[model samples]
Target chain A: MTQPTARSGDRFLAAQPRGTGVQSANLADLLERVLDKGIVIAGDIRVNLLDIELLTIKIRLLIASVDRAREMGIDWWEHDPSLSSGKRGLALENRRLRERIGELEAGRTGRRTQSPDADYEDDETPPARPRRTRSTP
Target chain B: MTTPDLTWLYAVARDVEDGALDGLTGVADEPLRTLTVTGLALVVGSVPRSGFDERALQRRLADLQWLEAAVRAHHRVIAELARTGRTLPLRFATLYRDDRGAAAFLRGAGPRLRAALERVADRAEWGVKAYLAGAAPAPADIAAPADRPGTAYLLRRRAQRDALAQRFDEAMAAAREIHAALAALADRAAEHPLQSAEASGRAEPMLLNGAYLVDRERVADFGAAATELGRRFSGVRLELTGPWPPYSFADIGPEVPETVDPAGTGTAETAEADVEADVEAEAGFGADAGPDAATGAAPRIKPPEPRSPEQPAAAEGG
Candidate 1:
């Protein structure tokens, strides 16, 4: 355990818990590694008769965390939104919105609308901001 | 009472004390045992085949109660062993046909298993997540001039968009800086994808999900640095958890020779895994794959073993 230290000026010394059980493992912590690391001992329990395979339940297990999974290059969760931060969702949304705006701008150029608001829109002197392709930096 | 049960494997250890696991039990209150092969010790317990059969296993896995109980049991054993000595934990529900099969497998994998154990010796993993605190209530700006309503509206919209972008950049910058500081303290570190709002249950977005493998001796120092980072960036709330088994750093030992595609030609399969995380919502079987909910704990879709004729029909899990 790290003792709480005094902050000197702008430098804030981080506080540490007086007591922490480092040995304990939570469900998330344990599940993180079970699939992407270690020895996967494979065995099959088969029940068969008359030269035909009836049921073959193959048991293959490896323990690993997300980091361990990535070390082995098994990083499917990075692109998966449900299991990850919603950056992927945000990226998709931004892309779709940009496309829609592009389409709208293109259509506006093809036909002059008689709407009264058109003059006000034209007087708007600002150039459109360049589209930002990245949702998360 | 005939128990044509198989051995439910938990973990493999290298230097546990003699009888360190004495009096310990496993899932369903079954007796736990230790089997040693080539100086590597395997921790296992008997799980009746009646409940563990493929059909029954799938059904039980779908039940959160059953899954949680089993995982708790499995983790309890690994945690105890890890506390005592170096251990390599197995995925939930790793089972063998019998003790003889387990022994043979251990013997065959002896070299790789030993290497894996060595890699994790005296090392533990720590989790650090950084979240952006909800943006200061949008800096309540009621100072808009009533005379210029249209200009004010557009200006307000523009300001909101700019503020949003600026906040994101600040959060990302804070996350990167914190991760770098923590990484310096740790022997090795990894950045995991962030958890979603539903999973985290926090309105502020998660900016960083990082795991560090710190030496047991320097854990305190690492923790202190993490705490300092949290304090330094008041805008982002940093969460530090664990000194857990080296779960995120244990892939250095063994290579599944057959599936070892350095080229990562498994794009099709990974896409399938992506779809699996999507279907998890409708499947209701690990639907709450959020970390808070039992690690969103469920078995991942294992690619079909070449030799096995039967595979799980449905692929659902994180």
Candidate 2:
């Protein structure tokens, strides 16, 4: 690794586009764009052997801001849990489950309450008749 | 067969003066030059085909030493050209067979690229990160009651867990507040996903990773807002780095152009073709896309200057 430049800390600031106290970029700053924003031009640089792609160098490049990305309609992270909060999806599912469970419980209790005679009939009918053996003794 | 020489695409700028790129060098220390394509000017350098071959470059990316050199050099060219005008930085190591291919690629995407450049015109990117310096102090460390050792131990553990969760919640709230305050100071903002401790290389947990697009004139104001937030949330280690190349804001619009190769492969190639398709760069600090993550000390934050609005202007070029 190279020894630290005298003012390595403010190197980016020193490289500011103008003398207006703008700062320079570090690796972290650079990667934030390289990874997320920017134009992703997919260049086709394939090295083939016997019709088989021995080496396929696809330059999947993307460098852009959130708005431009949105303008370009390339927002995959909004739905990706690892890259986004994704709380809306989870909340929606939770609400749906709670509503479903509430409806099921309501149906179960309503059926029981509305059919008291059915239960009574079941109990009464079971004991009303005496059992007869196939072989009468 | 002799290896074909490849042209490394560093960045594309609109209306950049040809003289602006004089003496600038790119990957492999080659002299940087511009290849005009329609209205776009691509900043590029010549490199050996063998050096940038897919298989060889994949192996090279794993070698930190080589990766660091390449990335630093690649970044230097982009950063330098960004100063010249509205530059659209290409992905690191974007190798083309020659200038003709690069030109065609740029020519095809001329309108999209122009739109991206215009969006970033007069704006610069600023990064704000909030980190939890350490675990919130334990609420209490009293020993378990002697009479109910087993139950007391469980209760004590639960308390500790609850306290930690509460602290985390408080930190996140502070992070959000900081981001909001900074966002208000800029024209646009976006929150990046939190990086893991392993990726950040800082034991302190990262609360927020955000980028802001500030008009060039308001950079000083943005810095002031950041400084004020840093003061307001002293408990959290807040870092405001940049005036960068609009990295977070420079995408080529939402419309996927037909010219781009549909089968674009990600950077993470496996040892054997079937390697886990993890596009995540290395899990270290510094640099995006990972393998060359540097272990450098975090940028130092100077003591806040006096609160006079004119201080920032006065400090310009200092």
Candidate 3:
């Protein structure tokens, strides 16, 4: 597939109508490629890992603050089941099993340190607040 | 005494023609220059030491406005150089004491640098990110029979949860399929960590964040494949970006260690002495006179033929 002999640069600009110039490119994409990936030649000026980490934290905070100001509940990853790992799935299953075991133990002992009803109430209430807040925005 | 200006390194290339970099400017709007040593050209510019010294750089990096401007300026230079020829873009803040320091560093890194340049020659990096479509609608709640309202309500809730889990599973499966299809068409593929909705500024969840190094000739084929995948997988949106300089595929060798200051005192004099000593030790040993000396001309590695088997089916299906 031989293309026209025009320079690859011109071809790039033509191919991407959205434009690959700095103004068109998003900051997150630029940061991910520029900072996180590339040739790492250690120059005289030393930018340690701590500095990069701090910059990343600052960017995240900046982005989060903007989201907060807009009142957009953009933390869908936390609630998205596909994005959540199998480990989280196992943790939820484990919690359910533990609750069942506690119920069984309470029935056998005919006494309870804390009522299962109280535990259920705790679980139901806290989760409800976040869900409500998310839906409002 | 005035401190000498530092050299801000943007990229490394082979055989840039005279006047190719004319009128090109880099970070801080400094005019770009090339320091060619042992056949590699270090595309650089001069920035004041007062602003780019280690202490000042640390402060500037923390300032989001300064970093954004600098990063954009740095990328603009690389993008312009890439227009002329194959360019290996350096990380954002690579600054040398002067041209001599940069040349010495290049001499030491010549062979590996040559290998990296060869690998990316006539190839462009393209990004493919996939996102889930607008929020999955909630499963309709079933009306409870009059007699056993509580049991019916619980059953309906369980059904809704199951439906959501199933949708999530299908979305993930579609993402894996999309990545596999795109990876087959490119010369090399890398999967970057997914960006969160907040970072991406999109309402939908990101499913795949990938970078593919495609032969310049096959960029069209690769892009077509991505568009096909987008259509094949309904409810999942695929975004194709770039023709980027090979930022994702430039890792060819171990990195040379940066000079570390054990003492909290980061004095410029000590750092200068250390860099000069490093340059002399490496350059004095004739490190640049190795077998890879002929890298002044571009190395011609055979380009892989564009893969065709599964692509035809995808194109037809779409």
**For all the models shown, what interface RMSD does each have?**
13.5, 18.8, 10.1
Q: Candidate 2 lDDT, tens digit per residue, B1-318?
A: 223778888888986686776776777778877887655688888887777776666555544334445665776677777776788788765677777777766655566676667767888777777776443455477577779977776666566666666666677778778877877887667766555432332335677778787888877666666666665665576655665776665655433443443476532211223322222222121223322222112322221222222234765443
lDDT-superior candidate, 2 or 3: 3
**Compared with the true structure, what per-residue lDDT tens digits does model 2 show for residues A1-137?**
11112222233233443433233333334444554345555654432111000000000001012333355444533432322434343333333323333343345344322211222221212222111101111
Chain A TM-scores, candidates in order: 0.21, 0.20, 0.27
User: Clash number for model 3?
Assistant: 0
Regions more than 4 Å wrong, model 3 = A1-14, A17-24, A49-137, B1-3, B134-150, B255-318
Residue range A54-107, candidate 1, lDDT tens digits: 000000001112333355444434432333454344333333333343343335
* Candidate 2: Cα lDDT at B109: 58
Each candidate's TM vs. the true structure?
Answer: 0.59, 0.58, 0.64
Q: What is the number of backbone collisions in each predicted candidate, taken in the order shown?
A: 11, 29, 0
RMSD of 3: 16.7
Candidate 2 docking class:
incorrect
lDDT agreement with native, every candidate: 0.52, 0.53, 0.60
Candidate 1 runs further than 4 Å off:
A1-41, A45-137, B1-3, B134-146, B252-318
lDDT of 3 by residue, A72-92 (tens): 333432322332344354244
Give the Å error, residue B234, model 3: 1.1
Q: For residues B184-229, could you state the per-residue lDDT of candidate 1 as single tens digits?
A: 8877676654553323323356777677777777766776676667
User: What C-alpha lDDT, on a 0 to 100 scale, does residue B229 get in candidate 2?
Assistant: 65
